[model samples]
Target: METGERRTATERTWMFPPVTGWTFDQVKDLEVPFDWELVDGVVVVRGETALWHNHVRGALVSVLRAAETGPYAAVSGQCVMVDEHNVVKPDLIVCDPRGLDVFEVECAPVEKVALAVEVVSPTSRQADRVRKPALFSANKVPYYWRVELDRDQKLAVHEYWLNADTLTYFPAPSHPVHQHKLITELPFPVEIDLDSLVGF
Candidate 1:
């Protein structure tokens, strides 16, 4: 390694003030400069998402926002407190916002969230597929969706519903893989044209 070599932002490690006894309430109150989430009561900072990921999220959010009827609305990047120790921020959340201002909500209760969505990125494949779904299922989030982009950039959507008896996610009646259209009615009636989501 050369002393003069420059490191990219992603290559550099950023540190926050060292502290212990980090609770969700305490961590939420602290003034932090970057995006972070609570995993087992520890603060894990996240890297910025890629543009293609953003394209899928924004496009899908727009579709959900329009498809959702009455009290429901698609809210992006909201924190759902999984428990006392785990707090996860899903790419999108759908909930009834009849009483409160959804925009002003920083930490949303799992009971209030009807559905959670995640757009898979290269760096987050493991978390998106395994950890996030487990957390959401354990917390009893009613519905969950995982969006993926294949090698040719064709979109794929995976849908799941919570099994109350088991407290885990069960696959939807059908799974429409690569470049297929997804039409579902559990959480809400939404016909998702997977190809339409990945324009970039």
Candidate 2:
């Protein structure tokens, strides 16, 4: 029994070895349990999501899905190919419905995505707060939202819209943060009541 238990643990612990200088194709071919992103030829494995992460993500996805009218659809944990060597999976993504398949095994083109949302987890703070926004803006993703859980466990939404000329994000000229609700016109009109949405 002890030997069998040890073998089981070892088998579960075995994972695809991380590689440097990998392209999107190489990363995609890897059969790992965790989602992966190719960041400038380096493979970054996504951390396991926690309960609160899913709770916040579910709330946002529900709102976005309900508001979906035409052409646009919202999804969670879909990969977006930024370039030949960059693929990222946002927590929630809103994009052309035609671009996604039933299972979402294939990555959606960055150009087709209207909004990319990241719900910050303890391990994902730096990447979500800094790296992803820059990458999304550089790819002209048009809209970006960062959801944060405050000390009091209330959700705070940070909104940004890409500046076409500069290819960077600027706070939506309207309400940008923690206004109890978000009302924006770009990527089509969207109004969400944050307090109620998060059940806070």
Candidate 3:
């Protein structure tokens, strides 16, 4: 008997093969029960985001699309290829309008992304704050914003801008935390009422 061996399914109802690492293009085809991402050649599954998290994403999408002064547009949960071995699905992405039609794009190239946003929740603290920023910054996504539930349990926005040379994120210089209203010219000039996310 060998330590590592295979098992026969026989007449089992369902069997999932042992798989490791998935390319960005192949991820969309996986019919799994939960939302997922591919990291380090493995499919990592996490429960779906909270309802409030999605509501905030939806609101930002509308705001960014309406405020677009360029050819970029906002979409929620679009898969992005971070590298040959990694694919990330951001909570929201503002990206170039090209190659965005259905049947045309399975996952967006990292170069096409303008901004990536993550709305922080308890379950996603590490992924949103640490892992995602590191990945996005290394890939040179122009901007990243983290929407958070602050100490008062009210929504706030933390903005980060990427430095191409260092491959890292620096907090936007002026405001440490953006709440109530967020007005910015970078990443296509979108204005949003942060508090409005909860009204949905």
Q: Tens digit of lDDT per residue, candidate 2, span 1-200?
A: 33321222112332332333445654465666666677776667688887877877888898888887678889898888888668888998999867456575488889889999999998899999899999999998999999888887777888898899999998877667755777776566778887775563
lDDT of 3 by residue, 1-200 (tens): 21111322112211332244444444445665567777865667765677877788888888888888667878887888777458888888988877557577777889999999998878889999999999999989989999998777679999999988999999988865788989888887667888887785
After TM-score superposition, the amount by which residue 112's alpha carbon in candidate 3 deviates from its true location, in angstroms, is 0.4
Candidate 2 residue pairs in clash (backbone atoms < 3 Å):
none
- Candidate 1 C-alpha lDDT tens digits along 90-126: 8999987666665676678787889999998887789
Q: Show how many residue pairs clash in every candidate, following the order shown.
A: 0, 0, 1
Task: Report how far residue 56 has shifted in candidate 3, in Å.
Answer: 1.2
- Tell how far residue 108 is off in model 3, in angstroms: 0.7
CA lDDT of each prediction against the hidden true structure: 0.76, 0.77, 0.77
Which is the better candidate, 2 or 3, if ranked by TM-score? 3
- Tell me each candidate's RMSD, in Å, in order: 7.4, 6.7, 4.6
Best by TM-score: 3
TM-score of each model, paired residue for residue:
0.83, 0.82, 0.85
